[model samples]
Target: MISRMFSRFNISIGSVTHQIFKKPTSLSRSVIARKFCNEIARPENFATAGTMNDVHIKMMERIGLEPGYSPIPRSREHLIQYQPSSADLPPRSMADSFTSAVIPLSSSKSLQDLYVSYLGHVRFGRLMQDMDLFAVWVCHQHVNIPNLDKNIHLPYTFVTIMVDKIDFTDFSPKGTSDIRLSGHVSWVGKSSMEIVVWLEQEFEGTYKKITRALFLMAARNATNTGPAPVNQISPGNEHEQNILIGGEERKKRRIDHQKMSLLKVVPSNYEQSIMHDIFTRITRKDTIQLDKRVLPANGKWMADCSIMNTIPCFPEHRNAHNKVFGGFIMKIALENSWVCAYLHAKSRPKLETISDISFEKPVDVSSFLQMNAYVTYTEMNFMVVMVVADVLNPTGGRMTSNVLYYVWKCNESVPEVIPGSYHEMMWYLMGRRKLNYALGLTSGV
Candidate 1:
């Protein structure tokens, strides 16, 4: 069954363009942090806006600074270099190169629409959207040079290339007040940077970590046409060095995974494979029907447990370059997957991992999108949800645009799912791979 599924998909290995990323070799933390703060410090005093109103004053304040104080170092005379020195800093410890924003979840309906799950806990998709948004904000803060014309901010355009290890160790209850998002450049490459964002809840004047995500975003040309150079991030501590190494490892792992997925190895040729027994059992039974899909012993099937949602590519969901937002697409896909998981479990299922979301092309705000999701795989209490997004054309046609897969950890209330067709089986195997990689059962960066 596994071999057949692999062959039916016609998977092939391909080469990816490789580039060498450079990192600072040696430097002390204080020196590097000092140089970094000086290089990227806000040129004009935030208080320059005279007679600031409540909102304006609030915007001018930095999270960790003293009241009314900004992130700009008290003095720049200590700096000797014009750019980042050879050291790394955590997103929060980036001196002045950080961005923070807070979103108050005051409305129940809006929370339900974006973050609430069938089980009433905040869904994972909402965090993914905020992670992407906050990563972009951090990237802009890091790379946006002061334009000669102050009114025209020439910020570097960016799109999320990948997000890895989004750990949801702490759950956010549905009615939790407001969450603060802070992010900064943790690693930098020639044309890419790793933005680490943390989602936290404030309680009695203290912040508690809810989730943290590592977003690998690539800088694009001012016109948003192709990859462009980005300022390198200097690591300033052991923690920062670890993050840079991790980012490097993840980049390599992503490339290797892409290659492995395309590898043309025949699964049936390996008799010693872990899946060999199952494959043999399924193939040897000639009397058993294979043409018809099989239902689980409990009679659970795809059609009975799936979700279909239709939404427009709203203008507010557009990226800086005016295309439909990738984060928005991910948000919808996550919601659909959550609904599908709920239908199968008959209760709320916790998100294990968002394995993958591949965008075939950028979507336009003018189009109507149809999102279809299904419980593609289930075993014990493990479930995998797949969401396929398509653009509805005016000529009665549909164009596939995005494919998202999520691995969920459900409670005992969730029932098992049975694959009914070769097509369904393919998704099942793919979903299994996703779950395995997410759990570190299989190698992923």
Candidate 2:
């Protein structure tokens, strides 16, 4: 069964057009095949080897993960002696950490084919994955500041904890346009830095903005798994100052939201908030239609949704810290959510925005990961899917690892998701807030 699933991948892997990175033209098909075979040939037990399977490899390829890939080494051996000291912070310029990468969104045939299954548009999930990956690299560069204690640079690992203020002004660059993804360290804290990333498409002569996002990453010490100090970013100009200010404001908002989320009860002011009003109005008896049959409901709640998909996490999909990459998790979550959206809407789902995604805990490698996606709410020409990923433990317990909120525009013929119970109603209201927040973000609220 596994071989059958990998049959297509085997063919694609051997093709010369499958080049993910620059390789020697003289590299033979046999060499490529051998490399792939070696990747999958490991200890029989996944718990022991954490080898990636066919599903993991295919998904990684769709999101630009090259097999047998190794990044350029940055650290030089014996460059400086390691020492421990608590001293003044090393200040760094934003330019020192700025990084930009350009890719032809349409010129790459492999990429185009990978996006073919995405309703004729470049997969939003893949684009998001690249954004996260690039942002992580930018943060990594910022944290690699020279150590005051030693001549060597501080070896720090970073992980993306939050993503926000995402505004995709235009559709993804699909055809022949080249997209330049740029990231810079905009603001810095004791152990965290705000990396702002922008995606632009090169039009006839000028570069047009496609999407912009903010990623919050925290630095972890190499020796101890604790917060590590990051270099302070000094703005060079007025524009840089403005960007830094924006990052600071967003950081405050993130802290505020985190605190609010932990509150056992909603604050008194929340009762007067727009979301509270929306929830109250939608849940009223007079506003709801009782006799009208919402198409596709069939009077059975279970028949109206999708089944759960469970997969195992593997080492090949992990980041530098051995934790699963956020991009990989996002891809699986989006795909599963898209399935639920398509089944309910009976139409192609075009992604609008990944409103919010919270990583509650790191998904342990070799753990059974289960994803559940359901259409929480549907309005005119739009649908919201809430996809949750949980890690199932050996003791038959489960812990929530991720919660993703997605928004998509659907076909007109698709019916709205009618809430059948109080629990579903709460989800419906939450969906409304998610959509509203996405719109506000686009409008620069």
Candidate 3:
């Protein structure tokens, strides 16, 4: 059976072109020509053999992890570091056109005018498995900052999700919305620089803020030799002092325009840079692996928060301060929970349990959020959507919310990654992938 499954993946040199939305027709199969046996397919039982496992684990980490780091968020204020390398960067591609989408027509919409007014940064979540693999694998390429002439775009496979900023808070699929997405590179680089991008939405009569990301690039060598040394800034540090001094930022200011300009503004030392450090060039990438995502709703309600019923983020949904009230988010979340379970039954299922929910944090009125649910663990006759609601920052950065909802998947099987032959494929299947990587496995599943 396993052999049969693997055979489906084979591709011959001379085969027919693939079709649209259908698996390919021709696949080359090989015969091991051995006898059949009943045993586990996994080569190593990761449980025992602590010593050997540790050795292999280190080796895997060395090769498995990408080089460079998550790019640093530009400081509202400060001088950053720099890295240098090839100047040419990958270009960004945009949609030739977008389809018209209709949002709810409301009379009393709070912040309605501002909901999706101005646009900036965007990161399309995973669209499919292979694309997701490529997305994760390519995080290390760097590009210059100032020369980052256009938007910073990267592609990943996903189903339905749009995270953006709505006035004061971030906006997501709050109410009914039709969001179309495609993929391409906004910026490409070898080192010391990268282009960045952002996005927003068009709704009713306004456009909203999507997300903004920057890529300060640095060039890497088989060995290390460049305009400046690499910066190793610690990521996610609110403190300014911990930032790296050399990488993309340094490369940005190093451009003299002339080989030996009359004036050289960049200091000779790497530590002199106050804005960036090694950590800064490292882009903070959120990997959403479909399978590794465990919300723990066994036989519980499940809603693919990315693209389900639009949970409104309006005035009636807010409090006295004009901010969207936490209570309203909770109420709507729970109600949506029931709706998800009902959908799972192909109509409606018995609402056996909510199991649990937590408002991890206040989901502001204008905040853009993407809520995804899953049945992380299960027991016979019971399952749930371990719900997760995440907030997106104006710069297209995301933060976890104070809320969590366990939607029930009343009638569903233990989910698994759509299987593939690559080690990366198995890794994702085994839940070894990242959180954002699972955007494709929605409640619709």
What is candidate 3's CA lDDT for residue 145?
34
What is candidate 1's lDDT per residue for 12-43, written digit by digit as tens? 22211112223334554433532332222222
TM-score of candidate 1 relative to the true fold: 0.71
Ranking 1 against 2 by TM-score, winner:
1
Considering every candidate listed, which one attains the maximal TM-score? 1
* lDDT tens readout by residue for model 2, 1-445: 3342233123232121111222234534333422332121111221110111232343333223355524432222232234222244567767667766666555677655754453355566666777787776676556543434443344455678877746566455654556677767778888888777777778779787777777778876643267777778777665565566666666665665566442333433432342343334334355455444333322224236654899988876776445678878888888888888878777777777777788889876668999999787665667788998999997899999998888878656356455565556556656765775665421111
Please give the lDDT score at residue 264 for candidate 1.
Answer: 40
Write the candidate numbers in order of decreasing lDDT.
2, 1, 3
TM per prediction: 0.71, 0.69, 0.25
Better of 1 and 2 by lDDT: 2
Which of the two candidates, 1 or 3, achieves a greater lDDT against the reference? Answer: 1
Q: Total backbone clashes of model 1?
A: 9
Off by over 4 Å in 1: 1-96, 106-124, 144-151, 174-176, 262-296, 302-305
Ranking by TM-score: 1, 2, 3
